[model samples]
Target chain A: MDERAALDLVGGLVGRAGDDAAVVDGTVVTTDMLHESTDFPAGTTRYTAGWRAVGASLSDVAAMGAEATAAVAVYGAPAFDAADLEAFLSGARDVCERVDAEYVGGDLDGHDEFTVASTALGETDDPVTRAGATADDVVCVTGGLGRSAAALRAFDAGDVDRANDLFQFTPRVAAGRALAPYATAMMDSSDGLARSLHQLAAASDCTIDVDEAAVPAVDAVADYATDDADAREMTVFFGEDFELVCTLPDDEIATARDACPVELTVVGDVTGDTAAASSDGAVTVGGDALPDRGFTHGD
Target chain B: MDERAALDLVGGLVGRAGDDAAVVDGTVVTTDMLHESTDFPAGTTRYTAGWRAVGASLSDVAAMGAEATAAVAVYGAPAFDAADLEAFLSGARDVCERVDAEYVGGDLDGHDEFTVASTALGETDDPVTRAGATADDVVCVTGGLGRSAAALRAFDAGDVDRANDLFQFTPRVAAGRALAPYATAMMDSSDGLARSLHQLAAASDCTIDVDEAAVPAVDAVADYATDDADAREMTVFFGEDFELVCTLPDDEIATARDACPVELTVVGDVTGDTAAASSDGAVTVGGDALPDRGFTHGD
Candidate 1:
């Protein structure tokens, strides 16, 4: 089974398992495991791998609208190279520091392939979940989409430095906390806009109708994609940008924008279209059906 | 570098890195990553693997004198068999239930080898650290030692049922919380009693003198080992028992005993003699030197 089906099985076993981060007693906790072959591309530095792996969990904390506190990683590889190990730690620490979180120590092990399992923790009295959205809520996202898609293009072109830079997008922790008070529902767009919108719709029991013209496409997409249509497809279907996708009432958008450090772009609106709702939820972009296609681990 | 040296490197990078579980705002969190080749022996079932992997993180929580609230694991394997996956989740959930903690959902991915990364979160107002032992405090252990060593022997003898049963040791969460208020220092002996004593001594800046005869070797050790000395060696040096080793004052032993559910076996005492202190904290057993030997991950 794919990641989504596996998650469904997990949800069946765990009572509180649907949220991006599991919040227990005001503490938000999440974990992400990345394998070298599956996650890191050719020429990707150990440092970049470390940063991206840990940042994935941090994004979950951000999705919960919690104050990022600390993170730990478990690194495994066939052999320990001093420089690579040091670089990995530096990357992990730097990313945590960027988001006002501490990079606590982690475990190390020997494995045939390089692997990283990162866990991030945060705190919040009020956590915004994907299940809280209403029909009238405006759908919005922080930063833009397709940054990771562009990074993949760069990696394909052997632009290692550019790819690494693209992989270093900041997790929207501050923006998440700022929008928590006003956001009806929130989650991270690590699985692409289309998939995330579908998830948000299903969780909130509503449909999300996207205005294609209003979707914020990162400039990097133009530099990497073959054409404008390709860029739009990349922005909607490719994931790993680590951006926050949230919903808010139309009246609260101005206040949320004022409080948020990053730009909040409105891309869609939650709708009361129960007739169109299916297992994948009714998600449309540019008046066209959006498929549930994105990064699926273990696929 | 080995696991200990790697830990030192990690300790140097993160200030609050030496504890078993990092305590932040009264919340304790710890993570453990285990690989199939390194951690699981032949004849091991996926269920046992899940139990032992998650149990390792719970042991860390128990060591910190906290109430475990929840746990999440990230599992990666070459392929996902329906039965294997279900069994793994069941094992993980059962272990959490045993400790009164929730088995929260986890992430899954495809990897070249089977791997599990588990994180456990706990809560506590007062956390017991490994650095609190004093000269006059008595060193004690909960549960017995050499259980895992015996399990390994069982596995070698093709006693899969007995091995799996032996591998399923209960994490001393309740006993740890009970001892927290009175114990001066506390840690789990996953790394075996000899190494644990050395670590406790070094962290507490004291020496530990052990009565070897008093060491509670599991009765199964006799069935596994060739002789009494072999059993004693296994009890002291072989690890993965998941028992708590603590330090308590002589006068408070009775109160601690009453509060604890498990047997509080007094095997040693902290000493003031600093002249003999080495890097391993001058640990001795039965008037002889006890080497810092135990299971070392990534060794």
Candidate 2:
């Protein structure tokens, strides 16, 4: 079975399958893994690896509108330099502090290649899962998308500095907290906008239609867009934006957006229909089918 | 820096560095990593891999005397057969079931080698840690030791079945829970009995001396022990036993042991001394130094 199939098998026990984190007895728990070979490109540094790995899991905490409490990492590598390990741990500690969480110590072991598995523990009084949206709910996203996609492109093109800069994303914790009280459904848009919409649709049992031109396109991806390609596709199809996608009742959108510390853009609305399926259900623009596009590990 | 040194660097934030799991707001969190190359022997089955990975982390929960609630795994491996993945998940699920914990969903990614990183979340009203032993406490252990060490020897000799049987250990969750209220300090003997004693002494600032003959030794290791080799060293040096080594008050030893489901062995006592250092503090029969012995990855 593939990853998704494995998830489906365990979905009955964990509850919401595609949600960023699982809530168990008031605790929001999430884990992420990063293999140096596939996750870190040639230009990546150990410091960045530690920071990005911890931050990615922390982003899941944000998606659940939880305050991160503590994090632990299990690091596996053949051998590490004393300085590199220290710097890597420093990066993890710094990132946890950035999200106002404690960095707990974890296990270390030897492996042929460098691999890090990080878990973030969080707590939330009123978590917002991706299962409450209804018809006419306004769908909004925090910040812009396609930054990481653009960064990957830049890295491939040897613009290492720009790529690194673009990959250093803030986890939108404050915005998620602000929207938690108002949002009906919420998730992190790390797996691309289109995929997020599909997941939200499936969870909330509603159809999410995006006005393609309405998506706030970041400038980094604009230079990479061709005439035949829609610049929004970069934002919708490629991921790692770490932005929060939330659906709020129309009456609550104004207050949620106003209370949010970051830029919140309303880009779509939910409709009740059997339109969440791929066969003629979702559309990106006029008569254009919205295909599922994004990243899935092991795919 | 070594693993312990790296933990000491982050010790300020998390408080106790070597505890089985970190407790935050009544929740217990711990993580463990397993790589196929070093962790798994040549003929290790995928089913055993998943069981051992999840079971290893759960053993930590047992060390803390916490009841496990949920577990998540981050599996990264080169393309695996569908049957292998299914068996792996089944193994994970079965292990969690054995401990009465939920097999919550986890992350899956593709990597060059098989790597499973598992984290277990647990809870307890009164958690037992490794820093509370007093000078007069009687040091005791749950279950016999040297099973894993002997298993390794068997594995080296092409006795895969015996190795697997010996390696499949029962985590002392029940025993730990029974001892939690009475024991002053506790930890898993996965790193070996001598190393565990040294750690307990270091954490509690006391000295522990073993009456060599009184220490329990499994027959599996006795067959492998040489004439000159001390029986206690066989149980102390090699690791991965998953037994609980605890310090209890002399007044409470009888009741604690009687209450424990696992067989209990009293091998030593706690004394006030600064001589617990590796050079000469610990001693066995005839004043022979019980040197530090156990596994350290990549050492």
Candidate 3:
């Protein structure tokens, strides 16, 4: 099956398996992939690469309005050295400490290639799922988007110095917590802004209209995007953004923004339909006419 | 790194990561691998196979002397059909239910080939470790050994019917619980009896002597062995036997056996040396001359 069908089947099984944190009561666990399709370097040994994987996984739990409690990582290594494994573990430990999430036990096995699987567990009074948004809700982002993608481009072009800071981007944990009480729907934008917006809209059974001009883009991407079209495309379709995209009541958005003080952007509004289109009329978030350029398994 | 070094490093990391069931402070947890190396089909599957991948993992936690609490499964699937994925999940779910373990959230990704990684958590009052055996401790087993290995051989030889029941051997949870209060040092023997005895001796810093007559073998295996010598070889070297090899004070061994009447065997005694030799002057258990012949990764 394709990604959509596979996801549907998995979602059904997961639902039956138990509710969120169903396996262990009083805990909510979430998982996300930092894969070659989205994250770069193709292996586990790049500088701060392991941290990115742990951070991306933790970000998923944080987006659900939970404080990360523990993490279980399964790494696939093919002909990897002891030093490389130590580096990966060290980086993961650092991230775990930073988030106050303990590094729980996990497994290591050999494979034909290398991949990192990180699962983060957290605790919360009530998790903020993706299906709580309502019509007339204001959509907001916790931090800037398109920077990680821009960093990838910079790294690929040997501009590592310019992308160094962006490469180690931190997940917006504080912002997620601050908005959790106010936001009705929450999810991390690992699969890019447009696709994530479409996901949030579909999950909440609401339409979202993005004010394209209001969405943030990295300055480096603007320099590379020779025209506005390229810049818009990069900002919309580029993956590994790791920004918190939330929908809240219009009144609560202002209060939430004031309390969090991150780069909260009111880039859209939730409507009553299942559509996610751009207000500028130039870009469409989930239009059939647009290409399916988001990250996919085996892509 | 080689398997020994890898195990050492991983053991150290796990030690530092936290103790068993440390995630839930009040609970105790244990873990084991039902690795593809020993428990899988001779041929590859579109997806990974065997309930043991899930069963053995949960059994470790169960033998920890704990109840199956939660589990996180990491699956590596080849580029294959969705039906295979569903089948793998179904098998894993079946084991989870059998052990009363809930299927917690985990990671799933595509790989160059298929593999399965399962981590199970259990709850106990005081956790059991491999280093708790004392000198003059009597060793015992939960069930018969050499059956799984014999089953594998039979299956390989195209006698599936002969091995079917043996292949689906259930973990001795009731027996383990009955024996836990008395077991000084304990571990499930996934490796061969000889290797597991060696491991227990190394961990407890003691010698273990096994009586050849005490070691159990299948009737078919005895018939196939022609004599005691062949049966002894198969019993010593054969792997994937998930029997609990445990040690208890000699006086307490009878109590343990009486608590669970399951043909408890007086396989050996724990001594203050680093050697483990069998009785009947046949094979030494932890002799330095023997080459390690159990299942190994990347073999």
Of the candidates numbered 1 and 2, which has the greater DockQ value?
1
Candidate 2 collision pairs: none
State residue A148's C-alpha deviation in candidate 2, in Å.
1.1
How much is the lDDT of residue A114 in candidate 3? 59
**RMSD to truth, every model:** 1.9, 2.7, 4.6
> Where does candidate 3 stray beyond 4 Å?
A16-23, A30-49, A159-167, A171-174, A218-220, A223-227, A258-262, A273-293, B17-39, B42-50, B104-107, B160-178, B218-234, B258-266, B273-293
Error of 1 at B242 (Å): 0.5
TM-score of each model, paired residue for residue: 0.96, 0.92, 0.83
**Interface RMSD score of candidate 3:** 3.8
- First chain TM-score in every candidate? 0.97, 0.92, 0.85
Instruction: State the TM-score for model 1.
Output: 0.96
In CAPRI terms, model 2 is classed as medium
How would you encode candidate 2's per-residue C-alpha lDDT over A96-117 as one tens digit per residue? 8888888877877777788899
Give lDDT tens digits, candidate 1, residues A254-274: 999999999899999887655
Give the candidates in order of DockQ, highest first.
Answer: 1, 2, 3
Q: Which structure among the candidates has the greatest lDDT?
A: 1
Tens digit of per-residue lDDT, candidate 1, span B14-72: 78788888988788889999988878899889899889899999999999999999999
